[model samples]
Target chain A: MKASEISVGQTFEKVVVEDLKRTQLVMYSGASGDYNPLHTDDLYCKEAAGYPGVFAHGMLTMGMTGTLVTDLFGAENVRKYGVRFTNQVWPGDTLTATATVQDIRDEDGRPVAEIGIETVNQDGKTVVLGSATGLLED
Target chain B: MSDEKTVTFPVEGTHVMMFARSIGDYNPAYHDPGKGEGNPVGAQVAPPTFPQAVAQFDPEYPLRIKDGEAWFGSGGSPSGIEGKPATSGGLHAEQHFEYTRPVRPGDVLTARYSQGETWEKESRRAGKLTFTERLVDYYDQDGNHVCRARGVGVRTERPVDQG
Candidate 1:
C-alpha cells in the first residue's frame, strides 16, 4: 500500500509462522554463522547452558518481523527498523508479526510512514516488540 | 571491547539471496534485481536485517556468543563482573537500524563498530545482569554514511533445572 493510502493506527495483515522447527534454526545458524549452542546442540543446552532445549536466534525472529514491513514498504524504502526481544522463542512455538501505522506524514517533499511493530507468540506473549519507518513514494 | 574499529563486508548477490532464503522471504527484489531497476539503490536490495548477519565477518566482534568466550563469569564480559557459571544462555535484548541508502550487490561497505551504552540490573534468576549495547555505522565505498546498527545483549545467571 502507498504511504498516502496507509492510515494512522491501521494494522496490516499478520504474518504467522507456525510450529517453528529446529531445521530452520540450524539453517539460520549456518547462514548467519550464529551457531551458539543455545540455539543448537540440545544436550549442550540442557547440560551446560541449563535450558529446556534449543531456542530461536533473536536475529532470526527479528528478521522474520522485518518481513511484515518490507512486504508492504519494500526493503529499500525501510529507513529505520528496530525491535526488543521480550520473550524466548522455542521450537513448535507459533509467532505472528504485525505492523501498525503510527503516522503518515511528509518529510521534506516525500512521504514517510512510521509504524509500530510487534510479534506475539501463541500464548499472546510478546516475543519481539519494536517500531519502524519507511519512505513512501508519491 | 576496544574504542572502535573498521569492519567491512564484501557484498555478493548469492549472499543476499541466501539471506532472504534463510528467512523464507521470497521477495523478488532480493532474488531478481530486475524487479528493483527503478529504485535508487539499484536491484536486489539487501534485506533490512542483512547487516546483523554480516557481523560475523568482523574479526574484532566484541561478543562472540558462539565461541562461548563471553559467557557469564568468564570475566570477559564488558561489565567485568565475576560470579559462578550460569545455566541459561545469554539473550539478545534489542536492536536498531537506520539507513541512508539501500545496500545492493557490488557495493563495498565499511562499518565502524563501537560500544554504545551498558549498565547492570539485578535479576531473580541471575545474580546480576550486565547489558552491553553495541553500535555499527556503515559507510559506502564513496565514504557516504549508508546505514547504522545498534544491538544489545544481556548476560546473567539462571537456575540449572530450568526444565
Candidate 2:
C-alpha cells in the first residue's frame, strides 16, 4: 500500500477462515511441520490430553490472522509482525481478522505504516492481538 | 540460558505454496513466480511467518514424531508415552518476527537458535505459568541476515480451564 493512499484510522478486514476444519489443521501441521498432537490427534486430545478435541495450532491461527496484514501491506512490505495468542481456536469456529492503520510516520527516513491487528472468533472473543510495521511505497 | 542449535532451511517454491495454502493465503507471489511480475519485492517471497517452519529442519525438535521413538501422542492408546503431563509440550504465548529482507525461493537459510528469557506468572485459568523465550536468527547462503524470530512459550501447572 502507498503512503499517500492510506491514512491513520483506516481499517481493512477479512473473514480469514469460515468454519475452520480439522483437515486444515492437519494440512497446517503437515506443511508447517508442527506435528503437535494437540492439534491433529483427536484421540489424544480427548482420552489422553482431556481437551474437547483437536484444536488449531497457535502458529496456524497467527498465520491465518496475518493474511489481513499481508493483504494490506504486501508480504514483502512488512518489516515487523508480532502477535500474542489470547485464546484457543477450535474446529467449526469462524475467524475474522482486522488490521487498522494506527500511524503513518517515517522510520530511518523511510515511510512506514504502523498498524494494529486483531483476530476474533465467531463469538467475538479475540484469539490473537498484534501489531506490524509496513514500509510504504515511495 | 543460550545454547547453540542450528537448522538449515532450504526455501523452495512448492513449500512456500503449500504453506500459503495452509494459511488460506493465495497470493501469487507465494505460488507462481511467473504470475508475480508485479510483486513489489521483484520476486516471489515467503510469508512473514515462514521462518517458523525451521522447526521442520531441527533434528531435535520435540514436537515432531521420530521413528522408533516413544511418541507423546496416541496411536491405539491415548498416549504412547506414560506418565507424561497432558500439557507437557506447553503452548505458544507470543511470536515476533523482524525482517531485514524478504526470503525468496532458492535461498538456503542457516538459522541459529538460543534461549532468551524466563519468567513466571499466576493465572486463574492456567494456574502457575512459566514462560520461556527463544530467539532465532536466519542468514542466507551469502551470510546476510535475513530475519530474526522471537517466540514465547508457556507451560501451565495444569490443563487450562476452559472457563
Candidate 3:
C-alpha cells in the first residue's frame, strides 16, 4: 500500500522474535564485510570481550528494524530511515520492532509522513531507535 | 600501545547516495528525486547502513600489527586472512548505531571512528582469524549529535601451523 493511505500515529505489526539469531548476524557480516569478533566468537567474546556470550552485530539488528519499516510503508515509499543502538543484543535475544507515525509534512507542498521506528528486546529494553520520513503518493 | 585513532568526515548527500547504491538498496527515498516529499532539496534519505559507506579509517591501519599480536594482527598471514570477499574485500560483520535525530538534506554530517577492540581465534571453517572493531560517531551541521555506529571486521588467514 502507498504511504499516503496510512494515517498518522499508526503502529505496525511486530515481527516474531524467533527471526533474531547468530546466523542472521553471520549473513549480514558477510554481506556487509564487518567481521567483528564480538558478534561471532563465543569464547573470545565471553573471555576477553566481556560479554555473557556472543552478541549480534548492531547493524544486523538495525537491518531488522529497516526490514520492519519497509514491510509496513512499502520499500518504495520510505524516504528516510535511521537508527541508534542503545544496548547489545546477544544471541537468542527476543526482539520486536514497532513504528509510529510522528508527523506528516509537505516539501514544496508535497505530502510526506515522518515515522519513528524502534526495536525492543524481550526485557523491554530498547535496542534500536530511529525516525523515518516518506512522501505519500499523490 | 596507544588506542587506535579515529577520524570523522562531514556527511554529503552524494556520499550517502553512493552508500545506498553500493548496498543495492534502491528505495525511492534513496534514489528518486520527486518520489518522496517532492523536494529535490537534497540527496535521497540515507539507508540504514549508509553511515558505514564512508572510509572512516585508513585502509592500511588494520594491517599494522605484530606477529602473534594477540588481538588484531596475529590470526595468520601478514596480508591478513580471507573468507568471503567483501564488496571491496571487507565484510560488515556487525554494526551498532544510535541516531539522536534524523539526518536531512542541507544537514552537514560528520563521522568520527576509533578502533574499539580486537582479538584472534580459531574457526573450524575459516581457520585462524583476526578481528577488529571500529566505533563511529555522526554529527549534523549544527554539531548536534546525529548517530553513532560501531562495526566489527574479521580477517582470516592460514594458520602458521599449516605453513
Candidate 4:
C-alpha cells in the first residue's frame, strides 16, 4: 500500500466516541511507570488543580490516532507519526479523526507522503492536530 | 510544585534498543547498526514507542486513587485504591506522542516526567471514571531538544465497566 496508490484527500470512516472514561489512568500509570499526581489525585485534580475532573491522557488520544493511521496505511508502511495536544479530551466526549494529504516528498530521495490529521470531539473541538509521514512501499 | 526536584538519566543505544524490544517493536532502524538500502541511515534508530521507557521522578506525582484521597496500593486492580478495595478491573484507554527528532544510536537521551492533569467523571456501571496524563520530555547528548511524549490511562471503579 503506497500513499501514491490512495487518492489524495482520502478520509477514513470516522470513529464515534464510544465508552469514553477516565479509568485507564491507573493502568497506564502502572504500565508506563508514570505517577504524576496531576493525573490521578482527585482532590488535587479538583480543588487544587482546578480541572473539570480527571481528564484523559493526551498520549491516549494520540495512540488512538495512530490506530487510525495503522488501519488506513498498515503499521509497517508508517514512517513517522506525531500529534500536538490542542484541547483536552474528557470521558464521554465523542471524537472524530480526519486526515488530508499534505504533500509527497522524497526523504533522502525516497518517496514519502505527508498527511495532516485533526481529531475533534463531538463538540467540534479539535483535541489533537498534527502531521504524519509514511514511506510508500512498492 | 513548580520548584519540585527532578531526576534525570542519560539514555544510551542499549537502553533505547531494549525499550523497543520490550514493546515488541523490531524495526531494523532500531536493531541494525549498518547503513544501506534496508538500513536507511546505517545506524539503528529507536522505535517510536521507545521513548516511554525513560524514567523520571516528581515529588508531587499524582497517586492513582481507588477512592477519595487514598492511592491505589495493590499491584493490580481488583484490590483497592489507596485503601478502599476496587470493584472492577482496569483497561488501557488511550495514548498520544509527539516526536521532534528520531532517536538514533549513540545519541545520548535524557528524559523527565511530571504529573500534568487529572479528571473524574461518571460511568453508568463503574460509578466513576478517572483519567490521568503524564508528560515526558526527551533531550539529546548535546542538550538539543529531542521529543516530548505523553501517555493517558483510564481507571474504572467496577470490573464489568471496563473500557
Candidate 5:
C-alpha cells in the first residue's frame, strides 16, 4: 500500500473463485442488472445459443479479478483499473488472480503503483489480463 | 455509433454490499455501514467496477427481462425469442475505469454515455469480430466529475469455437 514498501516485480495472488457456480452468475445478473441468458440460462445457452452451456459474464470475471487490486490498494485508492477478458470461464472452473508490481512512480505529484494483473482458470488458461494504477498511501 | 444517452444512478449502501458479495469480496469496508469510517476514503465505497452496475437504472436497458414484452432467456422453452442465435448478444472484450474519486453510498451521480471507437478483427475461435467502444462519464449531483468508464464490446459472426 505504501509506495516505499512496494518494489517492482513483487506479486500478490489470490484464488478468486472455486467451482464457479451458475447461482453466482445469477447473483451477478441480479446485482449488476445484466440478464444475458448466456450467463444464467443453461437451456438457452445449450439449445438456443449453441454453446456448451451457460458461461460466466465477462464483467463477472473482471469483477472477481478485481479483488487483487482492491485487496492491495483498497477500493478507494484505485486511480485507474482495466482488463481484457481473454477466455470464457465456465461452471466448475477455479480462478486464481495475480497482481504483479510493474512500477512505482510519481504521477501528478502523487505516488502511484502500476500493477499487471492476470487471472487464470484451473487449467492455467488465462481468463483475463489487465493492469491497474493505484495511489500509494504515502 | 454516434448516439448519446444519460442515466441517473444513486449509489446505495445495500446495492454496494450486494455487488461486493456477488464478486465474493466480503471486505467490511465495502459492506459494513459504519466499518469504513476509519478508511482513508472516510466512507463506504463501491468496488472499482461498480460503475457498470448503472445498467440497473437505465430505462431502456435491453438486458433486463421486462414485463409484457417477450424475454430472451428461457421460461417455458429454451428461448422466448424464436431463432435467436447464441452469439446474438455482444460480449465484453475490455473495460477501463479512471476515478477522480471513489463512489460512496448516497452519492447521486449522472452517467452520460457516448460512442467512442469502432474496429474489426479476425480470430480463429470467432470469425469476424466487430468491436465498439463506449464511454460513460459520471458526475456527482454537484456537477463534479467523478469517474469515466471505457468499455469495449465485441460481436462475433458466429458462436465461438470451443475447440
Candidate 6:
C-alpha cells in the first residue's frame, strides 16, 4: 500500500516464522562475522556460559521486521528504522512481526509515513519493539 | 574506542548475497545483478540491514577476527573489583537504522564508527545498568552519506544471564 493511502492504526499482514533452528543461528554467525559464543556455541550457551541453547541475533529479528517494511514501501523508500530488543529468541521458538501505520504527513514538502513495529514469540511475549519512517511514493 | 573509527571496503555482491541468505531474504533484486539492468537503482542492491553485517569488513572492529569462544572469553569484568568470570556484556538494549540511499555492489563505502552518549539506569536484571550507544555512518567514495546505524550496548557491574 502506498504511504498516502495508509491510515493510522492500519496493521499490515503478519510475517511469521516457526521453530527457528540452530543452523539458522550458524548461518547468521557466518554472514555477520559475529561469532559471539552466546550466539553460536550451543555448548557454551547451554552448559558452559549458562543459557538454554543458541539464540538468534538481535539484528536478525530487527531485520525480519525491516523486510516487512521494505515490502510495503519498497526497500529504497525506508528513511529510518529503529528497534529495541526486549526478549531473547531461542531455537524452536516461533515469531510473528506486525507493522502498523501510525502517522502519514508532509515533512519539508515531502510526504512521509511513520510506522510502529513489533515482533512477538509463540508465547505472545513481545521480543522486539520500535518505530520506522519511510518515504511515501506518490 | 577512538572518537572516530573509520574503515573502508568495497561492497561486493558475494557479501551482499550471503547476508541476504543468512537472513532468509530471498529477494531477487539482491541476488541477480542483472535484475537491475534498465532498473532505476542499478547495481545489485544489498538488504537494508546489510550495513550491520558490514562490521565484519572492518579489520579494526573491537571484536573482529575473534572466534565466538574467544570473544566471550575476553569479555573483561566490568567491575574494577575483580574475581569474576571476566564476562562483561550486559545486554543489547536497542538499535536503529537510517538510510539516505540504497547501497549498491561496488560502492567503496567508508564506515565511520563512533561512540555516542552513555547513560545509566536501575534494572531488575542488571541492577545498575549502563547503556553505551554506538553510531556507524556509511558514506560512498564521493562522501555522500548512504546509511547510519545507531546501536546501544549495555554493561553492568554484575552479570545477567538471558536464560
TM values, all candidates? 0.87, 0.97, 0.53, 0.52, 0.97, 0.87
Sorted into a CAPRI-style docking class, model 4 comes out as: incorrect
Interface RMSD of each: 5.0, 1.2, 9.6, 9.3, 1.4, 4.1
Cα lDDT tens digits for candidate 4, B1-163: 2422334555466665554443333444444567312444466665555455453232344433333565543234422344343322233344455556666656667676667788888878556778787766777878887777665656766532223
What value of lDDT does candidate 6 attain over all alpha carbons?
0.76
Docking class of 5: medium
Model 3 earns a TM-score of 0.53
Model 3 bad stretches (over 4 Å): A1-4, A16-19, B1-163
The candidate that achieves the highest lDDT relative to the unseen native structure: 5
> Looking at candidate 4, what is the lDDT of residue B36?
18
TM-score of chain B of each: 0.74, 0.95, 0.60, 0.65, 0.94, 0.77
Quote the positional error of residue A2 for candidate 3 in Å: 3.3
What is the full ranking by DockQ, best candidate first? Answer: 5, 2, 1, 6, 4, 3
Query: Residue by residue across A1-138, what tens digits does model 3's lDDT show?
Result: 455577877888565355356776665545444556555655544444334555675666676677566555554455566666666676677888888988867866768778888889888888887777665666
How do the residues B1-163 of candidate 3 rate in per-residue lDDT, one tens digit apiece? 3435444455556555544443334556655655743334434565555555444333433422234543421133311333322211233345555555455445666666567789888876446667788777777767788777766666555311211
Q: Indicate the residue-level lDDT of A121 in model 4.
A: 86
Q: All models, DockQ values?
A: 0.53, 0.77, 0.08, 0.10, 0.78, 0.49
Candidate 4 chain B: worst 10 consecutive residues by lDDT?
B83-92
Q: Model 4, residue A31: displacement in angstroms? A: 2.4
lDDT of 5 by residue, B81-126 (tens): 9877668699999999999998999999999999998999999999
Count of backbone collisions within predicted model 4:
35
**Please, what are the lDDT tens digits per residue for candidate 4 over residues A22-78?**
555554444344555444555544443334455665655665555555445444446
Q: Give per-residue CA lDDT, model 2, range B1-163, as digits (tens).
A: 5657888889998999999999988988898876662374467888999989888888898999898889999987989998888786899999999999988899999998989999999999989999999999999999999999999999998888888
DockQ of the two-chain complex in candidate 1: 0.53
Top candidate, metric DockQ: 5
